[model samples]
Target: MRGQTQTASAGGRWRGDGAAAWCWWWVAVVLLLGHLPSCARAGLLESNPGLAYNFYKNSCPSVDSIVRSVTWAQVAANPALPARLLRLHFHDCFVKGCDASILLDTAQSEKTAAPNLSVGGYEVIDAIKAQLERACPGVVSCADIVALAARDAVSYQFKASLWQVETGRRDGTVSLASNTGALPSPFAGFAGLLQSFSDRGLNLTDLVALSGAHTIGVASCSSVTPRLYQGNASSVDPLLDSAYARTLMSSCPNPSPASATVALDGGTPFRFDSGYYTRVQQRQGTLASDAALAQNAAAAQMVADLTNPIKFYAAFSMSMKKMGRVDVLTGANGQIRKQCRQVNTS
Candidate 1:
């Protein structure tokens, strides 16, 4: 994939297709609720409060729980680190809408590669884990800690109540550097992203839902400026907003990879919704991968469907559950490491 293009050939280790249960259930719910108002369809958990609690209990932890587990004063004592962690929610939310793996050095698998612990977030997770170890001992899983930290990070930044996720996930002992390749590149187009998600057994709807993470976080100028400067005929695609495009490119001239890019949701970058879809329709999408989503037939329709906030919310929730299930190193495959950044020296 290059400038103004996308590809899906970078395949990961293929996982089995057992997610069909979740996929089918997701489809049935959407089809049945398709006729209702978006908000009506969205009150899924509100209708069944226990289901919401169950989802959290089965999936991951919440922000408030993790804060209670660790000392923020201790975290802040390390000057360079706190600010780095403040960016954690931003990084994860920007890509996959607050998935914990955003802080996972997915690249930690290779024997020769030094652990590329993601900035300070992973370190923060470890610090919190230590505090939890003293109080709860082995009770809290590192995975849960990271998951809750990420949720708390998002809730804090957005000043919104985050959905509670289930905890009790164990820490991953092995960190694979090659796994970093699995993270979608901003330069990638439609094909690359689809293949990546598909290799993980994610389908088209899952792809669109996962991409909703873009509703939060800032994009760099290098990612979006090309759509404005490159005169690629694809730029004229009606999905893009001309005024928004112009405004984005104005201060972004001679775009450095460091220059700021606008948020997909012109309004709220924190709360999740279909704003990303709207941005794409206006030609304001920030990445070739993002724009390519609108270019494809199946993906584009999902984007269009998302214009209905209720449909988008339900799908977004389901898709998130699906994304959370991808390629997890569970059972005997990988051990839960005490430290995410390093393999056990013993």
Candidate 2:
């Protein structure tokens, strides 16, 4: 409540205790006005004629079931596949707009980028694509497969569909490692994070909500080392909780190997829930970008609001829908690769 302002009723109008209160009051008003519709919100696919819920109804009627079945099998065996797929979908979208460019295996492709080197689930995607090809060859797009696989992966974890993934997205021919610079860095500050989101047409709400995916993932120690071992006098990020810093130090000593890893949400690393916001609130967020949420007043308030499981789920679902639509290739644009790892030679 340090930055929060007090409000009072006076005659017919509400008054703030001070300038900080006025600032917070306006922020609340803006956020209230900007509130997005819930996960059940409809019409996105319908509005875009190129994409549709029943895109493969005539061509590949079993598209949904096939993706779901494969995703469940992989996630069940790996338990970590859900987070990996979600991150894979995100990295794909941010670079070339959810076009499955991240799936390319070229020498200078996005997958070879420094930040993308840790991205996994390519095999899971290939597995899903293989099944789809046999079931309905050349009908389903790799972009749509990536989108659907991500949805099914998370749905498998929650035991229910998280959101509707509209299909008909075509794969892109471009996959430059240089383009991966568009990705938001785990080491970014609040402003940098916001800019990255804005570049992709996402907002502050989307930034906080989508970040909840961190609730179920792990971070490499190399990603956490700067926050734990490099700082002011104490040589620790002051924003990080003291005890939590020591706990991380135990797992990630100075000059920690790139192979070392830690749970992003130490409280519940495998659960897709609101615990991520709670960790950020406690100053125990596992990355610099995660901790940066608490540094901005508006983003901080959004983070606080998202700590509620209900709010987090709804916002995350809506944001996923918006993200799935980013600069997609439809109609006769890009080709659906016969193999996810390479463009169609024909």
Best by lDDT: 2
TM-score of each: 0.63, 0.86
Highest TM-score model number? 2
Backbone clashes (count) for model 2: 1
Badly placed stretches (over 4 Å) of model 2 are: 1-49, 231-234
Model 1's C-alpha root-mean-square deviation from the true structure amounts to: 12.2
**lDDT per model, in order?**
0.51, 0.82
Least lDDT summed over 10 consecutive residues: which range in candidate 2?
Answer: 1-10
Cα error, candidate 1, residue 168 (Å):
4.6
Could you give candidate 2's per-residue lDDT for residues 86-172 as a string of tens digits? Answer: 999999999989899999998899999999988899998899899999999999998898899888887764556766788889999
